[model samples]
Target: MSGPFDGLKVLELGRFIAVPVCGQLLAEGGADVIKVEDLDGDQTRHNGPIMPFEGRQYFNKNRGKRSISVRITEPEVLAAIQKLAAAADIVLANFRPGMSESLGLDYESVRAMNPRVIYGENTAYGLEGPMAPLAGMDMALQALTGLAHMTETGPEPLVNPIIDYAAAMLMAWGVSTALYHRERTGHGQRLNVALMHAAMFLENNQLTHVELLDSWRGEFVRYLKHAFADGKTWADVIEHRETLLPHKVVRAYYGFHATKDGTVGVACNARTQRLKLMSLLGIDDRWTSEPGWMPEDAHAHADYVYRQVATAFAQQPTAHWIAALEERGLPIAPVRHSDQLFFDEQVKANNFLAEVEHEVLGPIKVVAPPLRMTETPLAPRPPVSLGKNTREILAEAGLGAGQIDGLFARGAVREVHETLEDLL
Candidate 1:
């Protein structure tokens, strides 16, 4: 059976992660996704932990989509792109606020041509905010949304651009929902997903504030502000914040422990599981059972238990701990590097990775399509080269061969015939 979105057409005017990924997800669902790139291509195409012409970052996000390179500033090129947008069922863009409007590819412009188009827009911040016009990136959004401060080992942002990916998921979900709405009402709507909003989505549980129950929140903020203004170091600020915050009694049960061979994560949430773990390590569970636990006493007992557990865990290898924890029905997992994933038995069993041969990079494994459907399973497609479909896309847009040749001659469009040398 064909995938659910087999006949859908998607036009992606996106750079970097969010929009490209949204388009990718749609393409995985069997949409015909065309990624429009500037003459220089997406910035990520040159970003490297791999070949400069097609970096891993670009490879991972732009899969399953055809690419067309054009200089949108040229009126003819703009008109050609508009033709694609007009025919698109869904239009995705991640340009900063007003950037789309300037390019005449905004929701208003596309909606005028195709009323049934679901236009998905991604930004660093929301469009109406004072910071909307200012450029935003994943790390900046993480810092702005307190994720940086929430890190245990000082104010460090995650190496991965999680917010960008999260925003992409939101746009994909929002666009899918809009498609359903259009199916029902015969009308399309615009959807906006901001990285700041995605940060909030991630921290929703942590961001809850009830004046009666969370009065310390205000005091903590004030204390943090005063501490920062006084030029206090992050360690100093963290120390003060810990004193103000409520005791995290179960924190010990939900943390990584360094074993003899490697790290292992343990998550023993239930009382019985904690008791079992304590018994296995030959540590006292008296503090957990006893009543009238004073703050100082509880802290001392917890510290002792934690240290004992740590010492015991360190005595064994990660594999040993994993087996022991599994035998006891406790939750535990050995920490493995990303490189190990391709060879992992569990990953292979689940078919989580798919191998494809790239024209330039040769055979490689990539993350498989995320969802699984028994009837209409998602299929992984090989990566397309930059400007690989430029000529075909222009032809599809109703431009004749002569027009295409002229566009190429004027440097208004480009095509990658067979190799990265085409771009160079």
Candidate 2:
């Protein structure tokens, strides 16, 4: 089937998560994505929890893209990449500061050859910042952005690298927006995405609360004091039973009681939903409407309600509770593991998973694009191996075989087996 971005060509000069993931998204949307790797290939090609024989991490983010291994520093390779950029509608890279310029792959240089190129860059910090030169990753950004501090349940903070994945998704959205703008204006622009900015944006809710609420600090102090005064650890204080907030108290209460065989994630964010949940559990009382219930103890009261609902839920298995909750129009779902997610009835019904036949790995499963468009649908394609299309991409860039072979002999271009058996 014809895809939305069928004619668009993208040259991806990136490694690891952010930029490559953006390229993958564009590729899923039907752009011809050419992943330009170094002579040794992208580092992520070696990152794994391998899937028996293939590089899982590489396959995961690189689906539907062709690979071109080239050392950007070499004149021939640089010339080849410049040609590719000239032919591309978009160019993406994630090199650190000064690296792209040193390799002659910076936006200005490429724009000189292709003025319509939508040059996108993903970096640890912004292009020009005090921390721009500092080595940054998702973990580092989380630490620097106060995400780790907020997520801390104990004395020491725990950082999750999944923040980078979220940042990558945001970056992809940014690039896609830029591409849309470029399509209308016919003026390609430089798009910059920094992990630090992405991390801060992701934590905007908490940051906004700190800025808006004058009493927020006091509330925090009170919470901490309560934690200590009650002789409870941070986890104890944060737990549903002790949250002292209506929603959390209720959520926690429902969380425990809503499970028999397995757990269920209950989302009762609205008053009507909460009411329905209460009615489903056969609870009707004046405690909800009573005034002077101690504003401070309001959360505690909610917790009591959750406890009652949970008791009802615990009486049945997860399936039974799900049916009952659905019948009452309550937002509830069973907790699903990663493997089980593939077979989820909803996922299968939506065709959220696509099967692609890999050259060496046979059949592989990939997630369909999360977006649903009536006119533009995403298609799945097999991921390319490291440098698998180097010569072909260069040739398409108008390079002759002699020039391509010279690059190969000059240690600027290389290719290897898809399985990495030769490198290993």
Candidate 3:
């Protein structure tokens, strides 16, 4: 078997991040995902006016999926898409709310043809709300949810596109789960995912008991600073000790530190780990005049402890700290950039990445699926050129060559081609 979802076929009408990511996940997991876009291609493919800078923006999210470009506004093209959707086991769409309905590509229309189709839709908010008609994205969702307020003192959205990826993961999971349910129940269902909901779920741990923060001051004030110079967030400071300690007793302890050469994150929250860290750092407990020190005052104690530990760690390089602390079971690791994963021995050893050959770009490295199924061997889908499989897809839909040619002639279908101007 190619994968668990080897026989499954999905039709994707997604652009940007969220829906495309869902299609990517499904494709990576061994599903045949067909990404349908308009004649100009996905909006993301044009990152900016500068041609050089507009490097295939669709590569990351639409990897492992076949692309089909059609003049979606044309009735003939729309009919072809509907025919494809009718044969698909799953349909993933993220059109601006009612756009799908206007185009006659909505769930109801597709489900009319294939009653067993898993119809999933991604929206900015959700169905049945005052904001349902409006458009939204990751940043908008962050602000809509309490993420902006809770993460930052004032209302400032998170810089990262966290919510978009979150929604993708959730949508993928939802589709898989829905498929499983259908297997037993012999029915398909509609799945709706919203960016706002994704952001809220991401903050499940942080948003709890947030009312207690009103009393914290001094060193606890450190959590209020979103930009901690070193890039650690406030949630990183409290971590797992959120509810265990009272506002007066809890303090910022376990987090990343900027070392001389780089950064290292340390977890020395427990008393034994604290002693272990102190001993490794060559700092005696007598420095604070408390042999078995447990700070009674959160502000003063946190300030004193962080000062000593930070100063000591800053004097040494990340490698030095790792060598001293990692083997000691002190739970310390160097803070590394994402790009560094390309060179990480552990990641490569685990086969977390794969190499795919692109016709124009040549061979390129892609992040493989993070999961491994012991029983089923899965081969990921490689990225394809826009409308690269249009003829084959239309043929599979039982269209004759003459019909396909006619559609092409009428400007309903298009195959991607790079011109000299495109290179320039």
Candidate 4:
């Protein structure tokens, strides 16, 4: 099937994760995404945790998009970019405050050129906030939004940058909404996405913990200390341990009995499930009978189920446990590492990976867009090298050969590779 955005044109004047990821999603949806890079390319091009074929994080995030290496500070290059923007259906930028207007690529300028252009801006913070000018990265935003503190169980808090990825997803959703609105209204709109705001929104429930429960702060601290002391990591502590109080029943629920082999995670929060688990394990029902299980006892109950399941699972290999759980109609999944995800049978069955031939890297595997539309399946496209499509895109913009050469000579347009050495 053809893609949903077959005829749409998008000009992405963004860098790093959030905005570039949004553009990647649009490209996967079949938009003609032109990524505007500087002479040195996006900083993500140098980011590590590299794939076997992709240069760095950059190639992974930028697949299915063309690149235009232009020095936007230069008038000629800036003018050329503006011309491209004028012809684009969407313009995405993640610049600091005033940077877009200074470069003459803001929504106002693009709107003047094309009333139907949808402009999207992503920032570290909201445009009007006191911290508007503060630079934002996933780590910084995590700290600013209190996510770091909320997740922390130790004296010193820890932060994870996965929050940035979530923010990018949110930005993509917002942009898609704006595009849908434009389709109906026949007028474009400006969209703003801030990493800080996104992080806070993601922590909605945690933020309201104090407001919703009386004496929640003291209880929370005590829970935190106990969960941490129990040897759980921050994520584990916050989720399964600290969130619930410790009591006899709770201890029974959360406790895990280790067997000779692997471990299994089990939850028996519901009365029926707990009874079923107890019956299956041949455990005494008196555990639940004494002192009706209070809300604080939930943790203990979970621990009890966890221990039983762990012991049972330890008697068999992971595959055996999986089959046994399925046979019993129990909800269970073996934990998997990120690298193992690609090899998952379901992932392969769903065509979650796409193979592309690269000039330097030869055949490379890229993760396919996660969004699935039965009627309009996404098509994989190779990422362009720096300014690889400069001449072609400019030609589409109606620039003659002589004009193109003039711009090339003037450094208004750069080539992807000037020499074989560049391929390396």
- Model-by-model lDDT, in order? 0.84, 0.75, 0.77, 0.72
Angstrom error at residue 73, model 1: 1.0
For candidate 2, give the lDDT: 0.75
Estimate, for each residue in 118-235, the C-alpha lDDT of model 3 and write its tens digit.
9989999888889999999887777667587443233566676989988998999999999999999988889999888888899896555445554443345555454367676557
Better of 2 and 4 by lDDT: 2
Q: How many backbone clashes does candidate 1 have?
A: 0
Candidate No. with top TM-score:
1
- Candidate 1 residue-wise lDDT, 1-424, digit = tens: 7887899999999999999988888888899999999887898888874554577788788888999999988888888899999999999998767778898899999999999999999888888868888889999988889876455456777888889999998899999899899899999999999889999998886888777767877888888767868977777877666666555474667789999998988998778888889878877656555544545645566677788888999998888888888999999998878889878999999999988778876787899988899988777777777799999999999899999999999989887555555435
- Put down candidate 4 lDDT per residue, 273-319, tens digits, no spaces: 66666666666544554545354455555566556655555676766
Error of 1 at 298 (Å): 5.1
lDDT pick, better of 1 and 3: 1
Clashing pairs in 2: 257-310
lDDT of 4 at 195: 86
Ranking by TM-score: 1, 2, 3, 4
Q: Regarding TM-score, does 1 or 2 come out ahead? A: 1
What TM-score quantifies how close candidate 1 is to the native fold? 0.93
- Give the range of the ten consecutive residues with the poorest summed lDDT in model 2: 240-249
Q: Clashing residue pairs in candidate 1, if any?
A: none
lDDT of 4: 0.72
